[model samples]
Target: MSTRNPGSLIARIGASLIVLGSASAFADEVVKIGHAAPLTGANAEWGKDTENGARLAVEEINAKGLVIGGQKVTLELDAQDDASDPRQGTQIAQKLVDDKVVAVVGHMNSGTTIPASKIYSDAGIVEISPSATNPIYTQQGFKTAYRVVATDAQQGPALADYAKKTLGAKSVAIVDDATAYGQGLANEFEKQAKVLGLTVLSHDATNDKAVDFRSILTKVKGEHPDIIMYGGMDATGGPFAKQARQLAIGARVLGGDGLCADSLAKLAGEAADNVVCSIAGMPLEKMPDGPAFEQRYEARFHQHVQLNAPFAYDAVYIIVDAMKRARSVKAADILASMPGADFVGVLGRTQFDAHGDLKQGAISLYDYKGGKQTLLTVVKM
Candidate 1:
């Protein structure tokens, strides 16, 4: 009992040294991923939801004992608040680059994503948008830019098609927020609506920040159209619907992804019932792993997902998949491996084409009923 076995003592020391060495390696190797969204203002809930998704993914990845290039890698999320402003998005992009983030997962709106894409391009980092639906985001030929959702080119027509065929809208009034997303979606909707023989009464503009749209609503109400399509986010679209009702404009309201939110009803009060919107993805219930993911999300965040959280979650996993395929965490290597990736996550198949657009896109139509978003149908494009 007094004598300690020499072999046992040596083995114990070796094990202790190995544990310390691994801990040191793990502490030294950290990979940063950037997320940018409107974490303040009316859209803050959306931003927070997306950030939580990225946070959950990072936490899980780190727990898996991630290793790249023989080093134990700890993933970190560098979330920045862009406030849905274009200029601020670019600034955040540069800041993330300065911080040496390997890849980025947001900048929610097209107005923000487009300007920030150049910054990420110059920095040689990959940027994937979870919610930006403007076609120009991918059409710009930026290899570094990608989006998980469908673009306005697809989403606009789907919404317009629904208005024409389902709602049988003979004439429609178009109102846009004047932002890149709003303008682009409105343009596509207008173009398709005309093709379908739907009379386009007027196309008006509004600022995203403006709450009082009486001026525009009054002008639009005069037209007496069958529907009023507001190309904007829930923040503006909600009030737009409410004001339209207030002005006694009985036309139904329609819009693209920007207006598809659970909070739209609360924002517009009872007026949300007249709103029909399209999101450039399948319904969460339709997503392959959506149920389990939703359970995990609520358990971790202690709140219902607002929007785009699933896409953001998948975006994080996509970046990690690329890193694993390349067997390196370097941005260049990860990006090099991304072009051919076929990662499957909560969103099903996450693949991109040469233009960095989704290989297959879908549009899910929804309508507000009794203060909740009710899914109508999902159209694949």
Candidate 2:
């Protein structure tokens, strides 16, 4: 004992203390939330906006601090860029699963959401899409799939009804990017448009990545349709509208939520004036919590909120609400609690039906005037 080296004993004590600290820190649980969107492509603005909404929720939750299963929990967002590609969406979903994310907040487009949804379902991870509206996304019987927005089923009919009854369009020409979201919306719109007695002059197909729509516009122009409906995202929809205006086509351009963004005005320029679109949720100014949320969002993001940001924000709270209800941060527990979620969020009461679709959903129609998005009407569905 007298010959014991003091330096060695001090080093051993220091190592022991480090191990204890590490273990103490590890006691705090980290709940990883996954977000997949096109953060690097033409849809980057929307993707980043969605990510920011989730981030805001995560920050707020962490600030308040969550206690799950008697342990301090920290929420972490694992944001991934799917680039609006279905192939990349699945890859991102798998990566999130491998990383052990407890839940997912996205796969923004229906095309990406549909393919990636299977992966999340297989992994038993609950995924709530803030923006994917294709009816097929939830009809597939994936218990893990959920959405905060109205589907194309409701949105399409609303747009079609408006076009037929309000806009008094006797004939419509449809152009789709041929994506799951685009085609699904176009089909639904055509179905309802037909029922409303509007003639389907021509239904054309264009890829999502296509920029030159002169050919499509030329064909559409030849039809002399009263309204030109495009089933695609703002990235393509905006350019298509601009080209239509450049070609001097007088038909009013119409689209769904994919084209209902604040940035569309800038993207479509003067053409945006004739652009009429529909979104899956009520206008922010109309939502009970919308104005306050907008102010908070602008302060945090240093920019205006986009079409789906509020939905994304509500989705994060929905996940956290599930965690709180289940009293655990485990994925299985969250999934178990998700079905009965009745949390009142910025978008109002968030309750899911058996199909994982919002029980009370609404579609808002919009148009651009003086380079600003103006809500035309709110149609509850």
Candidate 3:
């Protein structure tokens, strides 16, 4: 064999040095966990809430000091902004990898979380998504991507039951924003509606930034469905409400947790009222520990509580618990240790399976009656 070129040998050594440098950099730092999400944008509210909850958890965990081996390493919080874009989420994941964070908890939207999971998996980083409810998250066979809340599978079925039993809907039309979460929930709703003895009359799809729903609402109105179940975020559902009213479609509109954000109150105005939906977490008003969280959030950020805020808080705790058990903050170690962890948290008991799916969590249905999210029912599966 010919002798290797001098430049080639230098390149190989440089690459190896870079890798070792990165490892050394991480070893010198305290335990760092990342919170990556759209911290600023239309969906920024969701990201902000998720971040706040995670920050609170990290603070509390470090305060008490998690015993790992013979040392008590203080937890650190590092945040990245994904801007609610899947591509940005991927970049953020890479950034976290470079930082060598022990775990990642963030990117509230499922569309971003789904693709980012691949990055986390490739980097051997454990990711616990607080609010990503897409079924494919776990179905992909990646043990690193974990969710703290129930998936569209449970929420769709629960909402279908509430529509049939509570709304007394004889016929229902389904619509979604064409996102992974939206489309998944819409499809699941159609399936659950059929099983719940409600006739699914029509189906429609919308874009995330679409302002008009006249065409689809018009077609759905023609179907004469008693209800329109919207499997999209409040950003779209708010506009859909106005469009549905304009179309003279008197059907009561229903959406999933994405529509339960407090922003809906201002987005849809009066049209948002009487809209029913199922949310992933108990209302801040319902949980006994909620008021305290709300107060703390208000004090820190000078803002009201965020939807699913408590869920994110609990997600960080679950990760910390795993880290303590694994006696290391490394992602693969935390991932392997997460399964079978019993963590009582802000929402409820938070546990995990080998696939990184939460074992015990409850989904609640909430109605924006008047101007507030009122807890309607709770479902645990």
Q: Score every model by TM-score.
A: 0.93, 0.95, 0.88
State model 2's lDDT: 0.93
Distance from true location, Cα of 259 in model 2, Å = 1.1
lDDT of 3: 0.82
**Superior by TM-score: candidate 1 or candidate 3:** 1
Q: Choose 2 or 3, whichever is better by TM-score.
A: 2
The most accurate candidate by lDDT is 2
Quote the positional error of residue 34 for candidate 1 in Å: 0.6
Q: Which residue pairs show collisions in model 3?
A: none
Displacement of residue 145 (Cα, Å) in model 2 is 0.3
Off by over 4 Å in 3: 1-29
- Say which candidate scores most in TM-score: 2
What ranking of all candidate models by TM-score puts the best one first? 2, 1, 3
Better of 1 and 2 by TM-score: 2
Candidate RMSDs in Å, in order, are: 4.3, 2.3, 8.5
Stretches off by above 4 angstroms in model 1 are: 1-28
